[model samples]
Target: GESVGLHLPTLSVQEGDNSIINCAYSNSASDYFIWYKQESGKGPQFIIDIRSNMDKRQGQRVTVLLNKTVKHLSLQIAATQPGDSAVYFCAEITSNTGKLIFGQGTTLQVKP
Candidate 1:
């Protein structure tokens, strides 16, 4: 199936730094994109989203870049913080299903 999965178990970084989380998708027909942030024991919160027609989208503290050419995507966080320390997921949506196909998750570790 063309769902998301995680490549590594964890990623460790220091506070006040920038973090880049990567996601590898499975389906090439996906059109819309979204990024989510999940705490230790909670559901994912919407972070940012982009469409296949666009290459990039930005939020207050986060940015999402999509590379349809390779079926890959990435998320960039401006400053690493304890609050920013969580699991991240990338989702793809198309005209069909109206459901999102997620990518392999990446865990952001903030070392204070």
Candidate 2:
């Protein structure tokens, strides 16, 4: 059976430190990958994204790495702050359809 979801339920980090969030996906046919950050009461906000053709992409303070061979994905946040505390989710979209399949979310807690 095929599966699409997150690998962890939560992550804890100290303020001013870096944070690494991991996710595992199942569909090798998926073409697009995205990382989103959701706050306490807000919708998921886009962080970074990568296509299947690429293995890595970098944003302002975030980096998204994609490994198609093992079907793994990771998000790295630089200088994580208290404000960065939120639930993070990884989503994938295939070119065949516009629908996006979201993985189980991982809660990120930043300790000051």
Candidate 3:
């Protein structure tokens, strides 16, 4: 629930650059996809989401794409900024499992 003490993979990008974070999900039946951003000392915050029936969805400066063919998911951030530096996670939930699964985690580092 908290990102207070976690070591995650890192993805560095320059300011105003586009950043793409990818995740591979193991469950083919997962019906819901969600992307979360967790800054230090806080719980993961919702960024964007895509339904299994949808190939792509966009929210503000963020875009989420779902590839059922490869069981892959990705989040794209346009014009990355310093405030965007945080741990990003991809989550999937299925009706039968009733539990949300989170990706390994990736820390986005926006450099000046």
Candidate 4:
């Protein structure tokens, strides 16, 4: 599947501001979730991940949160910069299938 959908949600932020990206997953059985950042014409890069057993996890400058009740996930980026501008995606991997199903991406546009 294409990483970026035809109509992606856009998130605009200022430099040095915190950015929060949200996603809604479909499968309740998915046990693992990963966040990816894709720059223009570049492949997706691993950002952070969270497992079903955990509700929240933090990375170098990012945080991932999972809510099973609503099948919701969110990524928080601290002190967003122009370099952080890109399309962000959330993927879910079910233990049984071992397949990564990518959700719709959100384009992050950063202002200087």
User: How well does candidate 2 match the true structure in TM-score terms?
Assistant: 0.95
Worst 10 residues of 3 by lDDT: 1-10
For each candidate, give its TM-score against the true structure.
0.91, 0.95, 0.91, 0.91
Model 2 residue runs over 4 Å out of place are: none
Query: lDDT of each model, Cα atoms only?
Result: 0.84, 0.91, 0.86, 0.87
1-112: candidate 3 lDDT, tens digit per residue:
3111113388999999999998888778888988999999999999998989999999999999888998888899999999999999998888787788887799999999
lDDT, residue 17, candidate 2: 95
Best by lDDT: 2
- After superposition of all CA atoms, the RMSD between model 4 and the true structure is 3.1
* Candidate 2 vs 3: which has more TM-score: 2
Clashes of 2: 0
User: Alpha-carbon error at 81 in model 3, in Å?
Assistant: 0.6
Model 2 over residues 1-112: C-alpha lDDT tens digits? 3456777798899999999999888888888999999998899999899999999999998999999999999999999999999999999997877779998899999999
**Better TM-score candidate (1, 2):** 2
Clash numbers, per candidate: 5, 0, 0, 0
What is every candidate's alpha-carbon RMSD to the true fold?
1.4, 1.1, 4.5, 3.1
For candidate 2, the 10 contiguous residues with the lowest summed lDDT are 1-10
Candidate number of the best TM-score = 2
Across 1-112, the per-residue lDDT of candidate 4 in tens digits comes to: 2231213499999999999999887677889989999999999999999999999999999999888998888999999999999999889898987888887799999999
Off by over 4 Å in 4: 1-8
Residue pairs with clashing backbones, model 2: none
